[model samples]
Target: MPDVEDLFVEFETAAATTFRPPGVADVQRRIRGRRRRRGLLAGLLAVALAGPASALAVAHRADRPEPRPTPSVSPSPTGRLAVRTVTLPGVSGELAELRFVSARAGWALFDTCAGADESAAGCRRTVARTVDGGVTWQRSALPAVPDGRVHLLPVDAGTLAVMTRVGYLVTMDGGNSFASHPFDAPQAAVRRVFATPSGLYLGCPPDGVPTTCDRQRVLRVSGGLHFHQPPVTLRSDAENALVEGADGRLWLTVGDDDGLTVVTSADQGATWQEMPSVPRAARQLVLAPDGRDVWLVRTEQPNGVWRLAGTGWQPGPALPDDTDGIAAPGAGLLVVTSAYGGLGFVTGGGYVEVSELRGPLRTSDPGTSVSVLPDGTVVAQHGRTWFLGVGRGVDRSWLQLS
Candidate 1:
């Protein structure tokens, strides 16, 4: 028999000869192309120290589909809020955003490279609706456009504010049909759309052409398609998240070529107040229902901590573990899903300490998003689908978490 040490050396020699390093220039080109494509789609849109192949494996795990596992539970005497993981049905591509009008009725915006085909606009892009508490989902056909990204804001049970990569559309009759609003721009990218009590706030970046600087402004719409006010120039950058507080103030988080910027408007979006630098790479900004607190969830790690900077810009507290995403249940309550494992919550001023509600559901590359139902049930979106977990009951059902 061959010696074990000799066999191991032979195996290592064979593996080294078989493997070849990827060219750095080739990878750089791919990264640049992806960035340009993402910018054209919407200005709004991660990391591991592993090798390229291993990193891809990790990313695939983060974005993989798996059977919903039973969520871990942490009992608290205050029982202030309960957090759990919910899984929903997802299509191929990736889920961009999720919103719920009630516990059962909700809408999700999905984007995919498959839509690059000209046959069907939704071939790659879809707006999925769930009527039965995310148990199932039905895809709705959106108007065709060049890019294949959709942004949806549910006005009420029957109305929807829909924006595509090409332009804006609205449906008053539950998305069966849509009325297209023509806006001139090479790329009709919309970063964030907010349905405020006052009206609808549309955050769009500047046009693709560098000569025309006038197109970079936030547009306000009221009573369906009626243009209520002229566009407001908040930033030359693209806004990622548009959130409204119970106080009726509008908060906007904009991302430019440089970095992330925060601005607030107390009186609708007519006027704006620029806040201190958020100083991080952020994908989205969410405001608590009370409107007194603000949370910034960074897109990268190490500094991926959630910052609570409002009334005054100060670091609130980091999450219990490193997370790639975050969601607000209400004021002083936040749901954080780790990029590694687990879902937990942080509460109170000074934002001290975190308690895990569910630890690592064995999900691959968890593309997580959480929304609180009117009943306070926390629904989470992992990749292309959603799942629901009982807040205080410890009964976690894998109903679509969209």
Candidate 2:
């Protein structure tokens, strides 16, 4: 206590080394040490910032629930996905088929039962047109009532063809007048019909005549006026699939008791080549948007889809149900599960749930089919409710068109 300052100075001198200015090397070393300390601090800060997210992920994994069933008619969460309702003028009852050749021009096939009995026998199958993006519709009368199922295949904004059981009707003047064309093959042998820019293709009896009547041939009708049999033939009498890829290559898949046979025609069915045989009996064939990958819907596993790559068939994504229809809307793959599940957007070989479309609309009923327009607009119908999927990415929404 008597010599406190002197004692402190003595203690400092005992512990401290000789006082000298640090050199450039020492300064560099000190800076490097500071940089290391900063890096360590930054890493610690990152970990601290990520703690909540990591915990959330772990909690989510632990508390994850089973996949929910397709939602019923209920309001969606506020601001999660936007929904808009459209008014269809002069159009009522259930829309069976919807086809759009352009963004603004489209047609809808519906059963008109206004002021009549609700039975199918009382209802009349009718076709309607919308030239202003479905804002308004003009009902047109068909030349004859279809005895069975019919399909509307639009060739252009003005020219459209409707395939009925007996034959097909072509309207080159926007439903002003329809010209009927009967099938060259017997009505029973005409199983399916496909349309391309060139004309129509039909799955009918081989050579348009029946001998053994166990085989089918791909019938091409150029200009919708004549029937020409392509070179390719199928051994299956049950059913066959004919699809035109984006590259104008036609792929046909035939399933029989043995297995499946695949054939491709690059020259509009002028010439054909058989591809490697597929073991699974595929019930349907779907061409990818790129026109190279071919998808086969197997009869064994109806919900499962197989992708044909270079030379082999690999397992692709299994859809929500067998009723789901796959469509490429120029944004990504979309699976129209409206018949069983709701709408599913396909991503990374799986489904990214968009919306169940269960908002008091009948978009989830059976017999609903989905089709993508030429402008990438996805459309579907279930009962009288129609859904239009507009926008892309995050802005995409399933709008209910009444």
Candidate 3:
């Protein structure tokens, strides 16, 4: 495991910074739900250095048969960024989460229950990972991370935790050694878990329960594995995302059958308030270049893009119907719509196409995943596979990563 200072220095020394956009964009794109634990998240940084030419060798502890990965690695000429694909041998589709600790080290968790609740019949589960910058992969059996949706968060360079149906699955040495930490709350089922820049959090009462009627509260989970509710109430209606910006400000979107509610918490999740100027139907929010301003989308019927202004959410521009892939990194927003394949950014109150999506995507599959690495690498799911766009602006060439 890399030490704290080592993680910082390694990540900071990178010529290309890691990009972490809003969580809503992640959810909209159906990729990993959380990103950016700051210092704790250093491993996910895509180091500018090219990876080892030889494939890394990883073997499971036991004689258990492990899945094989065919990693394609290549170097670039001079100033270009090298891109490669890591094929997860046993991953048969239901890709739940991908937590790339670095350009080389990454962890992935998969559960094919397909949105089943905690009480439903279990599904196939596997925890696959790469230690040498995705150069090679070794997979082993995973404990029931039965949430259908799981979140992998790095506690440090070598340690990462997964929130699942049973409890928290923790690994101390990359993704090898494992420990189970239960939610030490009464009745303790977690609907959602969030890894903020400061700490970890859980949405109480779990999912499959009546999210609208049941009590939904945000509980702070400590490093000691204890769960304590925040001084605030959080709705766990499957759409809420606690969006934290570079300045540490947080915007929470809690929605249900009734309507939507947006709250802001300045000091992490200790307390909250009904933040005005945000939509009641907003499923996600992101900070703008100014840091004070925020942008949101309804994502429901009559979907629209809005910006916060003067104590209220004002309509900014018309969102292309069925927009999903969302990545907002201050400079602007990178978004994709279902109808026109308009993969663009919000500019001067309207969406401007930045790159033409290079895939045959169906009209209904408004891709629910988007990722921006610190080095300005943009990742979006075109269909079952992922496409990477390099560099800082609209001049992006796409590369497919499986």
Candidate 4:
């Protein structure tokens, strides 16, 4: 009988070669088929170990099997960004989180579950790296299995970090290996992780429960993964939205007893200057691909959207009622994700809908998301397919990626 490690190596190779997202029905069939093969392998291994050489020899005859599984900045010719699909080698399943440190290098976190059944026990947490844009990918092993959604923070081309309810995972040599770090000091669940030139910051709540994190407490780490509370003070009792500028400056919105206010910190989080308060509370902050513009999105009823101008915010036209999240493809335009399904591009004082792209980013499909690359290209994920949004206005189209 072959070694246990060798058996798994063979199984993985066969699994990768057999799984591909050709269509909805095809993916389901492949998943079911792979599960059966895995079950057979497990049963055979059990029987072989249960007895002696005789059982091993008999189990060898049953061999068979298979299976497996960013935004940019520039405005295109038509006033919006154009997208061209770049097939990723060795990648399948919907992207749970996609982040890029540069135009050429990035990382993605996804699972092996078929369709929208992410709660399935078979959904294995998988991570992949892409160096040549999103053209190809290299799979990496995780330090520990994630409990829920893992936040992807790319420090550079090779260094990156991921955080979940458990703690932090850091990889200096890309994703080759990851080292675990505990979330002890803060003693709260890390909902958001941000990377800046100064270091890494984690947004943690007072307690582990509650859907929204109040208190405006941020833990900053410089050289090591040790998270300590910074000297900076925030006034918000609600949730705060944070974003880093091109010049390493930090901008965030705070909602306190006085209402909602915008603030910026140039010297890390030591100090901040509060701007004029806005009418609505913004839940998310997005910086443009070029990093020259910032937009605040309020997911509440009216779907309020605002662009930073001087010290105040300039309100854009109201987004659709079903708006879930927003991303900036360029300096002035926006890509809005709908709760029903699909995306919308805000341009020419109005918006154009991309009906072909299904799976509403953060709402109906919680796994789906949209991001702009540093080069101004908009990338979005639908069910099991990834897409790059290219062209502008009517020319805008989605190119499917692996």
Best by TM-score: 2
Candidate 1's TM-score reads 0.55
- List residue ranges in candidate 3 displaced over 4 A: 1-83, 88-97, 101-105, 109-157, 162-168, 182-193, 200-214, 223-241, 268-273, 277-283, 287-293, 309-314, 339-342, 349-356, 360-368, 371-377
Model 1 lDDT at residue 374 = 34
lDDT of 3 by residue, 279-384 (tens): 4445445444224546665545555567777567777665555454454544655344343343555455555554334233334554434554423455555444
Residue-level lDDT of model 2, residues 1-402, one tens digit each, is 113222222212111100100111132233335434643111000000010000010000011123334443322222243343433455555666565555577777775543343223545567777787677777765676554445565555666666554555767677787777653432311221233333334323333321234444554442222233544464432224455645677665554445456677777776777776545455445554335556555423334556767666777665554333445453335444444445555544455555446443343444444445435555655555666666554245555665
- Quick one: best lDDT, which candidate? 4
What's every prediction's RMSD, in angstroms?
A: 14.5, 30.1, 14.6, 16.6
Estimate the TM-score of every prediction. 0.55, 0.60, 0.56, 0.58
Report the lDDT tens digits of candidate 4 across residue range 1-402.
224333333222221111111121222234345555763222110000000000000000011132110122223333333243433356655566565544557777775553443245545566778887677788886755654434555555676656544546767687899877654432211212232334433333433211133333553433233243333354232223344555566665443333345677767666777665556555445666445666666655545777878777888765766654466766477776555555767764666666455323334433344555545555565554556665543355455554
Candidate 3 RMSD computed on C-alpha atoms after optimal superposition onto the true structure: 14.6
Report, for all candidates in order, the number of backbone clashes.
21, 0, 19, 18
> Cα miss at 245, model 2 (Å)?
1.8
| Candidate 4 global lDDT | 0.47
The TM-score, computed over Cα atoms with residue i paired to residue i, of candidate 3 is 0.56
Residue 114 shift from truth in candidate 1, angstroms: 8.3
